[model samples]
Target: MGLIAGIYSIENKAIDSGRHLDKMIQCQQHRCQGGEPVKYINKQIAIAMVNPLDSIFSEYDIPTNSHNPISGLYNGIYAFTDGIVLDVPKHKIYFESNGLPMQDNTCSSIVAAAYQKWGLDFMLHLEGEFSCAIWDEKKKRLVLARDPFGHKPIHYYSNNKKVYFSSEIKGILDAGVNPGIDLTSLSDFLSLNCIPYPATIFKNIFQVPPGSLVIINSLDIKIKKYWEPVISVDKTISFENAAQMITESLKEAVKRRMMAKDAFCFLSGGMDSSAIVSFMTEVSSSTVHAVSVGFEEEEENELEDAAVMAKHVGAKLHQVIAKPDSFFDMLDLMVFHHDTPFTDTSAYPTFYAGKLGSSLTDVILTGDGPDQTMGGSGHYVFAVKNNIFANRKKTFQFLSGIGAGIASALSIDPTPALFSKIHRKLYRQSLGPVHAAYDIRSYFPDIVKKYLCTKNLYDVHSAHNPYRHPEAWFKQAQGLDDINKYLYADMQFYVPDDLMIKVDRMCMAHGLETLSPFQDIKLAEIVNKLPGHYKILQTKNNQIITKYILQKVCENRFPEQILTKKKQGFGVPLEKWLKQNNGEKIKEILLDPGSLQRGYFKGKSIEKFVNVFLENKGDYFFPGPNAIAGLLTLELWHRRYLDFI
Candidate 1:
């Protein structure tokens, strides 16, 4: 998808600083690294873009007749879109979108169609992973919109003098305003692994949140939500039908995604990836190459299972045996691309995977969204089971008995330490799922949070924390069950900001396009409306399963043993990395005099974190390796993007 940046200044303070807009665009050129796309500006309002059409073709091929940069027309109403529009020809109207020229629609077409038919109601028919900009000539108004799931992102900054918008934050910073770090967001980023919408790491610059749109003119500015995930717990379909529907819908989604001439699949050896590969192979006319990454340890790698699936699908398998130093070498580039403190250590593996996949093809499909969308997370399993007990401490103590039994039977750790960990895991959930996810998964512990932030840690969160009250997400879906409360909260932030952010940055770094079949709108609607329990189902034999329908999709294709495998995130050996000789680079960067001089985090607290990290004790200060990685990642990000300040 192409990137867009613009400046809209009121007539009284009008300025034609096209050079600044160009600089803004230059910062985000990596989003679509290949070709130069046209830009249009009028009456002090400017728009810059990398066309979505190049998402398919490396060359510029637009229909001659449909729409061109005809002089006066471009001046009045300018439009740009960052993702594909499927039904451009469905309306025969003059529309342009990100995809290759056909009947495909564009951000301009949608604006034109909306005025032609539904007036302001056009968003009801809008569908795609897109962020769009439209400037109105007659009204002197500008509009911005993002897709429901925010698959494509839109960010903007508004001051009394001007309003600036872009697909990334660098564009806003490029306007010569350089709003420094938003400390609140910096705190949240260290804790949540991302900064949520409307608040970027920088103040003033803001995200036009998902499912929302913004309109601006000389007199006023307005933003409204046009659509959201319709979470309904009402279901009439049988389990068999539900499973079949998920399988069929996903297959069709994957088929539609396979529109490219030479698309490949990212096979992680998990059920989601395996099922996607199976469907891709079923639909493709040629052999599909699947790419995967594995680590040195058996516990940290899944290459064996990946090999099994590659053979099952009769596809060529490309495996990268990853090590700590190789990942560390790319650390600075990773930090720059992320544009924020992205501490998901797995991003290292994804970065390498994308780099590897780019050599084979420009288009690849990934297995994302299943865990957050369908409740396939191991944490969810533990949370659901944990919520069952009134006295969680005692209940978990009992569960510890089961864990103890399993450990003893398997000749594993049956120590008191194991029991204590089992206790904390359950105790965290007893508070809430999102809370536990945040608190338990947080890199910086409360003790460390004190010094981790320059401001008082609690004072840093003067406003309510969304993690503590996940129920807020379910207010719209009042009939939604507990399982969905977590799902809805995660869908809103974690999946999009964290997982999807990683996918977007890593893939674009290599100039490749990634499609996820599981994130299909139709498929999401079918599953979201169903009872949340369907996400984690139980068989007659008392077997509990997460992503039940997804597991069913690849049952025949994946082996029986594969079904029992626990959920595994991309395997980045974080502890091993931090302990490596090269790993000392992380400590050097994090503990740099410039890093401490920022005075954002306390020196004493970081020193302690560094001590534990260097010793390689790795007991998970808050959650262990993530703490060290996150701190280092943030320091690197500051050094890369914000150090100039």
Candidate 2:
């Protein structure tokens, strides 16, 4: 919700550089705490705090009645232990908060508390969402930290004399930092559609990972992770008891998120969203407001399903129809809004859905984490197979589980070709421990494989690490018969990076506060430990399905047709749209001389992909259109950031 920037000079005084920092602050001033900038300058020290949205205050809440007297502070940085400045000297250490606190502590409180408790390690305890920095006046050092989920961005640039940092990548680049793309990261984007942790588009510039802090003194830089997501157990509970427990926790999760002056919920007619909205309606006296997006009548529509739920819950629903015209218009806007190459075509409709919610409420609540937590993906079966294979000591049961899994995975009459592809690919890729290493390595683009990973990021991805290990990912899955490793990977990577990023940017762009009930600290823990059967149950037709408990919850409220519907997530029809007007523009940027000239991709290979896309009857929106869209989006972003043409 905000941007923070600071500079620490190693040799000379930071006088002129501090003034330069002010100009840098102006560029992201829109992100300042409601557009306010706090500049503290001393002889050798300079600090600047900029918040783009509302700051967090524990004692104060937005008056629900709208008639109560205002509290102590509206929007201001409360300094707990003020740092000293010498003779109007520039202060390079600055901290600011707008959306949510990373930890329960205030910026000054955490800094002061950290200095008090563990000396410099106090940062380990703080939680919430924040981007903060500190300038060491005497030693001429700069320190920065970002919240664990990376909802906030912290970009920094350091040379010989001064170190400049900010919450936006563009802001730091604007501060005279090199904006050139990191040659090593090109493959990272092509493979994963995002720069991996601790890396960014720019070479010298890097993003501080979530739950991490960075310190720089005279170019001696250090980055450390202070937090990670972990699943805890409540071993005493039975399956039925756990289901009841989850329901209760989910109720409270919905309740806490209702803490808004005026709130809206995204209702996608899917199990996850419908469950949240249903809970919200039951808890609130007034009807909850709901927003949804559907493609123009013909292609894939969810309006009827959304309407059914809305009627049952007595909520007022606003639906946005993604007519062909609207799809292209939104596509253009999404390219700019994302500011990067994102392959998730669903991002466009998701953006529109958020925009729709923004106009109606000051805050919007979403159901995002459930699918990941509950084993909702198609790949969960393979993970379960691998788990059974690993655990089976007896030949009979082990062989039986493997046969069942392979049969379940290979059953062609019922399952989609995509499901088959995912299952075969996972099993093929995970044939032995070595292929797991190869799978990890193949996840990156060839360009990155060749140039960037000299240290072998794949090899570094731990065998025991849940983030990379196929078995660990399998164990994390909640499905009954099949384990969804793709769901596991999606939760760890996609949920935070693409979905959460989309929500944060779209909502904050208009100053609307958005919260995710599924992100509740406790509910996530419970879901993480639930038995896979309750998470994913076998359908009568034998396809894997999600949220058996949730399905039962809505059984009386909605029909089977609605609950069993295919998951057509809020996404754009990018492939279909690209074939229309200015489609070639996307192709041009993707295959631009720049991507080739810069050696990010092989020009011939890029052309071949485009040719296949144009010729084949493939899933255009998934890979074909997505690759072109992402590449073009990045090219447009480069123009916006660099050429400004």
Candidate 3:
């Protein structure tokens, strides 16, 4: 919702140039489109903001506060807060808020009512999303914090003495910090679709994770988590009451998300999105605008469902028919925009869909978090049926089949062999104890970790949170399904940090704000208490899906065909794209010996992968690693950023 930028000298640089900082802050000016940028600079400290509060509010029944201008940045709207102050030499604090306060003088109020009581802990008590920074000049330190859910991102860089930080990565780069590509993050992207929190595609720079506050002092940098989802299982509620609570909570979550000045919804014709659009219509008096992207050759099932929902709710619908040519055209832009090697083929359409949405509104509401938070995929079914003792037996059988298939294929090439081997390893991990909540994450193999990353570094990264109580999550479950544990871990880690980060960054990249209704903390708390049956609802052929409660609340809102349709997820033709048109270019980037000198990947394995993909016997197109896509994306990123060729 806001941007922050500052540079502190380790050796007291005493430099006072705010122009670059202003340009950096201006990069996010779309976040404050209806207003202008506010800037302040002094020796050893600087700050820039896009908008200042209003000039008058008495007519609106909102209280007004007197403005104390810092070096002459006046309060405009007067009711809200936006402006930056840097009193570095004076050992004082400079602060601003975008649109949260009832009065201007209440900046003092945050100290008494919020900061003093909790100290840095005050971040948890905040209701709205914001990025805040304080320079303790006397202490020679800086403190930065983001809201608990990471609705905002803060980035920083330090060189022993001086520390520079900002809300956007581009801000730091504009400040003249070296913006080197972090191939480690690219590896993570290939493993997980998005960059993990605290690590961006940029080397040596990091984003502050959500629900976290970081302190940088003469001593060291420290980060602490203030909030996480805990298992609060209440088995007492009957199925009927649980259903009702979930229905009401979800409705309320959607209602709160509708408070934007302008809003649009991503429609996928699935239960989550359809339900969101339906409730949005029921709650709002305004006409809702819905946007969707579809393949020209894709089945019209989703489009029909989307059309039905739009008609049912009388929403203004806009569809972008995605032709193969369009994907090919935007390929470079998508790679450059992400600035990392992303393996998620769906990201292509998501980017185009976002482009379509940003053309209309500054805010877009999405249905990305619910599936993982609730029981959304085949993993949930596996969770339900998994038995630690019995599943291990099944695991051996599955592994044997995988092993036989790999061995009989008679390809000693380590790339495909390692690829298939790690998959079986994940399935083995998935079968572990039936209660390792981290299975959802561990589902992706650690090929890079095994051979690429060092034992010490990989151990540090793969080490599970010691605070996590796997037993507590498992004990809360009435049924001992492996899915519940997986869901618990996903909700705990992946939902807030990974999935939420992906949607937020993609939308914000185009200056579009995204509101995650499903990430409503209250709604997640309530749903966690529901019975297993209510969550799993009508498992068929061992597959589980969602929204049993939604049927009761608004049965007519979704089309019958959509309800019965198999889930055809958002996927891109990466292999098809590579093979049909750009295969040689992709293979060259990944298999090139010159590229191997980058040191993030094994050279030999990559060559084999390219060879096997060309032969079409690797089956690399599914839910596992597609080496060509990962390598091509990284090469594209390298070309655009590091090499600058």
lDDT to native, each model: 0.70, 0.56, 0.58
Model 2: per-residue Cα lDDT at residue 400: 45
lDDT of 1: 0.70
Misplaced by over 4 Å in model 1 are: 11-13, 52-60, 63-76, 89-116, 296-298, 388-437, 445-448, 454-457, 462-471, 474-478, 538-543, 621-623
Q: Write the per-residue lDDT of candidate 2 for residues 147-181, one digit (tens) a residue.
A: 55565566677666666676656566666776566
Top-lDDT candidate index: 1
Clashes of 2: 34
Write model 3 residue lDDT over 278-372, tens digit each, in one string. Answer: 77888888889999877655553267777877887788898887666655446566665454555556676677677788889766777776666
Locate the minimum summed-lDDT window of 10 residues in model 2: 83-92
lDDT of 1 by residue, 565-584 (tens): 87787857677677788456
Q: Estimate each model's TM-score.
A: 0.86, 0.73, 0.77
- Please rank every candidate by lDDT, starting with the best: 1, 3, 2
What TM-score should be assigned to candidate 2? 0.73
Give the poorly placed runs of model 2, Cα more than 4 Å off.
10-12, 15-19, 29-34, 43-46, 50-143, 215-224, 232-235, 323-336, 381-491, 531-533, 538-542, 549-562, 591-598, 617-623, 641-645
